[model samples]
Target: MRNVLVPLSCAALFSLGPTVASAAPEDGRPVADPSSSVAASGAAARLAPLTLSVAIERAMSAHPRLRAAVLDVEASDGAVQQAALPPNPSLAFEQEDTRRDTRTVTVLLSQPLEVGGQRAARTALARQGREVARADLDALRAEVRADVVQAFFSALIAQERVSAATESLRIAGSGADMTARRVAAGKLSPIDETRARVALATARVELRQAEAERVAARHALALATGQEEAAFVTLDGGADSLPGLPDEADLARRLSDAPTLRRSRLEVDRAQAAYELERARRFPDVTVSLGAKRSQELGRSQAVIGVSMPLPVFDRNQGAQREALKRRQAAEAMAEAQAYRLRAEVLSAAVELRARVDEIDALRRDVLPGAREAHAAAMRGFELGKFGFLDVLDAQRTWLQARMQWLDALMKAHRANAELERRLGAPTQQP
Candidate 1:
């Protein structure tokens, strides 16, 4: 059996079939490097076509959502830096007795010391927060990659549909021309010629609709790639370029390390660290002061030292500690729930991918060949005056329907594969 599809005779179905490509990368980065080629179309300039890799790379490099996620990571880094800093020291000056000989001045410098491990706990929490932000960035990157892949395939499908419609229009026009000639020669009824014209008109309308859909799909692909306008009019790829699906066992093996689950786990760690930091706050920090005092009356200088600390009276961070603990619990629950949901989704996508692959195989191997043969036979019989024009129309419709269904199956298969890769956290090798 052919892996892609067989071309029909006059209809030329699957002649320009859609393609699928890998959206996930092995190293968890964007699929391909960005290229500076393929600029937006000018008034008379023809833009170069884009490959799937270029489109994905452009999205990863320029997509606003990804930039926002990177900013979150940078913000978390700032928080970590702030958390590591020691408390600022205070300098105080006092003056008393404005009389000439009774004037006294004292200079005091005090520094708060973190004796309760609050700095360590705070810094740990901030680092964990940064990890959570990084995880979020990774998750967002994976999502963007999948979105680009889906949009790319959608455009490819639209392109193929326009080709199919154009072929149908040609076939319909040929049938109409043949019927009109036969009617003029008095070998066919006037109604047969009318029916042929109606089919031709319908084909024209279908072609127009398909062309519109292709335009919409191109716009969607541009948006997905973070472009302000559709930059390229064509895509570079071939049919059946998609990687094969891994078995259920492989998907199960990759489930635990999914990006979403990793983010959720990081959230739990951050919440636990926050709880520790809050508990550390229950012990008040101490301030130590050291300075020199000068007396105008005595005409001498003396050194002074003192220490102070809060008694933790009435506010031992009880509320904050409780909140942090509750949040930690919530994070744990959420992580568990996410793991469960991800497992289910991966399995579902695997099943869907398998089914679509099988359906596509059946259609190519068993259905399309028969439909093409039937349509060709009906056309021949109609020309020989052994069959009605309606018989030819029915066969043509059946063939068109089969082709559309095959396209639909291919679209679904591409989607399922993209979803499966996204959930797997990384690209799997074809088996």
Candidate 2:
């Protein structure tokens, strides 16, 4: 288990592998977090990679948070029907005794009629709450999707690192073999062969550690995908390759629709509906009663009707109305804050993404080719007795490190894009 939070709501913090650190900004709150890329290299290719959407869909379907949100919405929907129902009627029976054989018998029925638009207001409030719950469900889906995609990329990086470590081990073994041949032929010292063997041993240790990390990363991905047993599923994803960058200008336009911001706005709307309902409650309802009165001895019957109402002098519902108004105001303020944070996040991620793209390009075009050529030349020179064993070792180490850096850069670029999408409250591109 890893102490890292990701997706929009810190959902994956508990299950990220040992290598994952929760340093990325969540939503629009600017935490000075580092990028979530790991140190790794390109190596063994995955046998069958799962697509990003398949991973996300599997995770979302299994996540209880999204299901809970749906249930909340359904409950809110039920409230609407409850709100629309009218007050039930009441019935009463009465008997009065008089002197002698005279007696009076009465039967009455009363119905309370709702006034001041209270019923309509209550229904509106319930409907608004449903909207808010539905919006929250939408946000939940987006967050889960981001988490799965990022985890897939992390696992992919781990596998590549394992391959790179294996490659390094192979190089070390080759150096040791060459040194032994030279020592036998009286060309190199026995101590040189011992040094080569030591390097090979170190490479073997590194390869084992790298393989362990890959296993951990894969397990973490399985957890994020909500596989109950952490099954060994080879995740195949295009997340390693950089997707086309979104237009920065278009991101601003998309802000209004961002899931977090949308939920905030819905909160405001729901609060306003509640406030209106409270205000509508200031007036009292009217209850009308009808009865038949009978005098047994006099053999007479009479029809009677009466109306009743509550006086507002005792309580005008002023306190509740004021509270509702304040709540609505608070919701509006929160919505504004979320908007500001979301806009800032988009700008920040965009700048970071561009810089990473340039770095990756430079490493691919100018750095890697030269490092490879240098290592190759050193190897050839050593075989021809023009270079020392140390020279060859140094060249190989430099090339290995350069490749690792390149891989790190690539992973960082992918993370920047995923963070941007998470903050956007929706997927910017199909994974």
Candidate 3:
């Protein structure tokens, strides 16, 4: 197998994470840590939280899809070897009644000679095909990394929601306690106390729902990392701060480096190589035979040498060459289409990321703080009997909604930035 270059890893945490890259493959596959033997042993030590970079590496090292793709590189390598070899020589023996005093015996050897660079063409085509597969592996690696990031953040956001729900439940419980006391003191109506109890019940329901979502998210993250649901141990990150993204100008340049584009380019090269191979095949090879003929009647041996070749009168490979040309044309068109599609994808992701950033900023910088202050004031006013219990309930609802919305926006922004990281082929704040 040819040397396979593993695509660089996108270890940026919203452009802030560490860079953890896999080394290039010597035989068209990333060399996994031979100590993946450690996975079985340290699998027990995974009781601690799993970080995103480590998770991505683990997925690459162990994912079944990644391992299967490596086999293609190996198969292509075998094909290249086969294509580079000369045809094996054939040996034959014959006995005939010569219509003379003695029977005749003969031995013949024949070797097919591949001329017009057919072997070279076949080898080149196979090499180009191997390149296409390697590029595909790089693309798959990028996909796996992107999926890990998305799933990790999904779990993180679910965690944040659970926290928000837990905090809301605590506030609701506190409110209910105060309402019961006010009713006993004849300062608040019993009907209002019932409303406070109902509000507490709703908060408990939301908390349960949030917890369920968190559990589901964890399961999903585990699956994305190629583990059992129970195997992730724990997720050790928060979604409080989304990482920054690269600007459009920089992203445009980076986007061209994406594996999808590189793979498309390789496709074109392979197509051209195929065409060359077909063109080389249009020229026929020669079969040369050399042997010794023995005749017992004469008690003599004769050496014979001869060559045979197919005439180009018919089946000149024009049809196959035409097919190869058409395929090459299609490959070129597809390459162009792939480039355009990548540009569109980068532009779209950048636009959405900017909007999410603005939305999250407004919610955090303005909406959330005001909502918090309003909820706090409502609590203080209710304690002083200056505001109705209904007013406190409304404020609490508003505050919870604002916090959840802010968390949601932050998740979106992170996801959009992750898309940028995928489309641009990598993420590092320094870039």
Q: Count the backbone clashes (under 3 Å) in each candidate.
A: 0, 3, 1
Q: Report the error of model 3 at residue 88, Å.
A: 0.9
Top model number, lDDT: 1
lDDT score for residue 202 of model 1: 99
Report model 3's TM-score to 2 decimal places: 0.87
lDDT (10s digit) by residue, model 1, range 1-431: 35344434423534433222235654667654344233322522335677788888889899999999999999999999999999999999998899869999999999999977999999999999899899988888888887778788888888889988998999999999999999999998999999999999999999999999988888888888897554676788653555587876777677878899998999999999999999999998999999999999999988989999999889999999999999999999999999889988988988898899899999999999999999999999988899988999999999999999988988898888889767775755321
**Each candidate: RMSD to true structure?**
17.9, 19.0, 15.5
Which 10 consecutive residues of model 3 have the lowest summed lDDT?
A: 1-10
* Overall lDDT per candidate, in order of appearance: 0.86, 0.82, 0.85
Over the stretch 16-37, how does candidate 3's per-residue lDDT look in tens digits?
4323332455466766686896
lDDT of 2 at 315: 93
- In order of lDDT, best first, we have 1, 3, 2
Model 2 global lDDT (CA atoms, 0 to 1): 0.82
Determine which window of 10 residues in candidate 1 has minimal summed lDDT: 36-45
Q: What is the lDDT of residue 60 in candidate 3?
A: 79
The TM-scores of all predictions, comma-separated, are 0.86, 0.81, 0.87
